[model samples]
Target: MNEVLIITGACGVGKTATARVWAKAKQGVAIETDYFTEWIYDDSLERFTREEEKLVANLSLVTAKEYLAQKMPVAIEGVWSPYGLSLLHSGLKKKAKNAKLKFVWLYCEISENHRRDELRVSENQMKQRVDIVSQQLQSYHWENYVHHIDTTYLTLPETLAAIESK
Candidate 1:
């Protein structure tokens, strides 16, 4: 059996940093969902097409299975919603025996101004995405299976230590 850690959060919430530290500490592979799609599309900068999104989701499932088969600790970092979590659980249920799945939600209660600054988004993009994200708060509630980490004011090293302690 393999241990899999799924680090999910909104964009610019430090998923990449957490993934980097977690992978280094556990000596596991870090798989970013964006990169999975980027390889398929051969363009990381362009907006993801509908087909690209589907392909990435499917590939994420495959990657999970592969990691489990190798008995390697895997870290999947992405903006995976509750629906995505359901899909992952379903995909891995048959392949893994007593699969150890851990969900880490990177909760950063950053103000709109700070978020805009940190994300480095243009005013137009900020208004579009931030407005929707703020209204919906898509990343706040997990499906009763996620461990919460309030990253409002933690440094990278401190955050890494917190995860290591867990």
Candidate 2:
């Protein structure tokens, strides 16, 4: 059976990079929600609203299901809220009923987040997003069903190991 993996985190938390490597390792496909959001926003908006996030979540989950139905393992990366994740979890199970579904939220220290954001390419760099997303994640109450990984001190491989274990 195929698998649906949701690799989520605040901006600059390496969600996209991790999903790419994970997809390669598992011989699956990786979908980045940012690209979808970019398209919806016409690539002009620096940040998206909650309503927009909901749209992106639905769109990405539907896309993931399409791939999973074909026996292709899928990894979707984004910054989704608890409500959004809950919906995605259910949506992924639709087409791939027998597939394994997992959600991993990667996070790091505020300073580390800032540093990482700066290290990213100028075009994709997100300065305020790092802090804004981090704060939102902290204030929100996430469901215990999801795996929360603090990647402040972990390397990419180590982070991947933790996610796999979860």
Candidate 2 structure quality by residue, lDDT tens digits, 97-135: 788888888989999999988997998787776777788
Please, what are the lDDT tens digits per residue for candidate 1 over residues 36-152?
Answer: 743543223333455554566578778877876776777888766666666666666666657777777776664732463455646323334433433344434577767777777
Q: lDDT of each structure? A: 0.65, 0.82
What is the overall TM-score of model 2 with all chains considered together?
0.90
Model number with the top lDDT: 2
Candidate 1 deviant stretches above 4 angstroms = 37-55, 112-131, 139-141, 164-166
Per-candidate count of clashing residue pairs (backbone under 3 Å): 0, 0
Q: Identify the runs in model 2 with alpha carbons over 4 angstroms from their true place.
A: 39-47
